[model samples]
Target: MLPAMIDIGVNLTDKRFADDREAVIERAREAGVSRLILTGTSLECSERALALCERFEGQLYFTAGVHPHHASEFGADSQRALESLAAHPACVAIGETGLDFCRNFSTPAEQTAAFERQLELACSTGLPLFLHEREAHSRQLDMLRACRDDFERAVAHCFTGTREELYGYLDLDLHIGITGWICDERRGAHLLPLLRDIPPGRLLLETDAPYLTPRDLRPKPKSGRNEPAYLPHIARRVASETGETEAALRARVLANSEAFFGL
Candidate 1:
């Protein structure tokens, strides 16, 4: 069986856990999740993520960078600030950064600029890129291609694209992070074929918790909040869909996480 889970993406700075963050983490450990990588989406959130890392000690690690949605706020000094946070031993990667055309929270030009800047920083620090791309896969891929020489490690986190997009990412040698979104019947069915094609070594599992709760939940949390505690269900579903034993799937996912994040 898979050893346990390492949630590669989560937004703990979200207020959804204001009252019971400790309990949430306790639940994750109960579910066999050994580590949680809190995503740093903005400067403020990065700081909060760092604080949470400190609070949880070795159980929780964090990234230090900004999200594309906040790209408009990215200034010349943003890289320096991110570098300071990323220097912390608990900081595992640099981002949640990329292009998000769906939200339009930032202009396309601004997002592109910010994406490149963070990619450069990640290259400089030798940290993996925790990427987010939505409704802009073509442009995102183009940007990645431009930085192909610079970026050595990256994951397309919370991937929700088509099979072609999946192939494109894999062809570029980037890792794939799967979220509980795959458990949804309506929108996620299209991803089954993609799931079938992913090699054991290239896949990573994540909750993107406080967000995409898996469909098989029992005694569901009242607030509809997804937590790392629910990660095992994600693995189970992937096993069922991919025709692999759950134990084998779990072991592969654990290995993938270790290699991808250097955990």
Candidate 2:
């Protein structure tokens, strides 16, 4: 039997899963993905994520914060809402929050302000941070470093960055999350060598579902919607790249997720 694995990041709140979220989750369980941490990218989604966590109980958990893409939506009321959400027993972290300069969906100023506020929220709630970053790693790291001593823990979710950025995050002792992006032979080729750079205990695995479908899946799903069930495929690829047995990688990542998220 495959050992249990936790998908540290999944957007179960996405509209794509609306038709059959429960079925998707069941499929994940059968595929050995035993726990999931739903990501909240906005206020509404954060609330919805928490509700889903409550419904699924032990099998589902969630992060509460606004994404940098939606940073414009962050305002005076945002902190109050996030704080209330973070107080929930099912809310395991404070984010989906950080800078995303790759696409200026939200102004840089808005993104930075929102990111800082969420960092403060993480410190206030004493919850781990589930962070996101793109081309804005340098600035994100600056802000994170400023308050890094305050938060209990933090992970850079869906990391797809360069070696310098990866090492920068590692230098700060931040945890790194790997997604199916590593499966792509085109853009992800560089990540193959960087896998060995991550320290054993700081690496975490995720699907970032309804997005980043693993490109190498055989008989790939027609919908092209990634799910926790496909996590093993990503894991197999990581093991291959890092020169470790799939079983060993799975065990190590599972332990990392448990420790990082207090699972």
Candidate 3:
């Protein structure tokens, strides 16, 4: 049997899973994905994720914050709501928050503002950060560095950047989350070499579900919606690159997830 694993990031609250979230979790359970941290990108999403966590009990936990795309809507009310949610037992982290300069769904300035506030919340709540960064590593790193000493912990969720970006996060003593992105030959090939760069305790695993389904999954799920069950596939790819057996990789990744998230 495969080693038990933890999917440290999952969008279980996404409407895509509305009809079959329980079935999705059951598949993950059968695949040996022992636990999940649902990603919350907004107040509505965060509330839903928390409700799902309560429904699923010990199997689920969630992060609470606003994503950069919705950064424009962030303000006093958002911060207050997130602060309230962060107090919940099921709320395990303080984000889905960070900068995303790729599309600028929210402008750089707005994204930065929202990210900074979420950083404050993380410190205040004593919860680790669940971060997102796409083409804004330098700015996000700068902001993180500024308050690195204040926050307890953080993870670069769904890291798909370059070696330099990976090094930047490692330098901050931050945990790194790998997803099915590494299973894709086109965009994720560069990540293969960087896998070994992430030392043991700092590496985490995730699916970023409803997104980033491993490109090569045979007979892909008919819905084409990613979920926690495929984490073992991502682990297999990581093991191949790192020259560790999938069993060993899963054990180490599970340890890292437990340590980072207190799972």
lDDT (10s digit) by residue, model 1, range 204-257: 999998998877577777888899988888888889989988888988988888
For each candidate, C-alpha RMSD in Å? 1.2, 0.9, 1.0
Give the per-residue lDDT of model 3 (tens digit) for 139-248.
Answer: 89999999999999999999988988989999999999998989888899999999999998888989999899999998788888898999999899999999999988
Q: Runs in model 2 with CA error above 4 Å?
A: none
What residue pairs clash in candidate 3, if any at all? Answer: none
How should the candidates be ordered by lDDT, best one leading? 2, 3, 1
Which is better, 1 or 2, measured by lDDT?
Answer: 2
List candidate 3 stretches off by more than 4 Å: none
lDDT of 3 at 48: 94
Q: Return whichever of 2 and 3 wins on lDDT.
A: 2
lDDT of 2 by residue, 143-189 (tens): 98998789888898988989999999998899999999998999898
Q: Which regions in candidate 1 have their CA more than 4 angstroms from the true location?
A: none
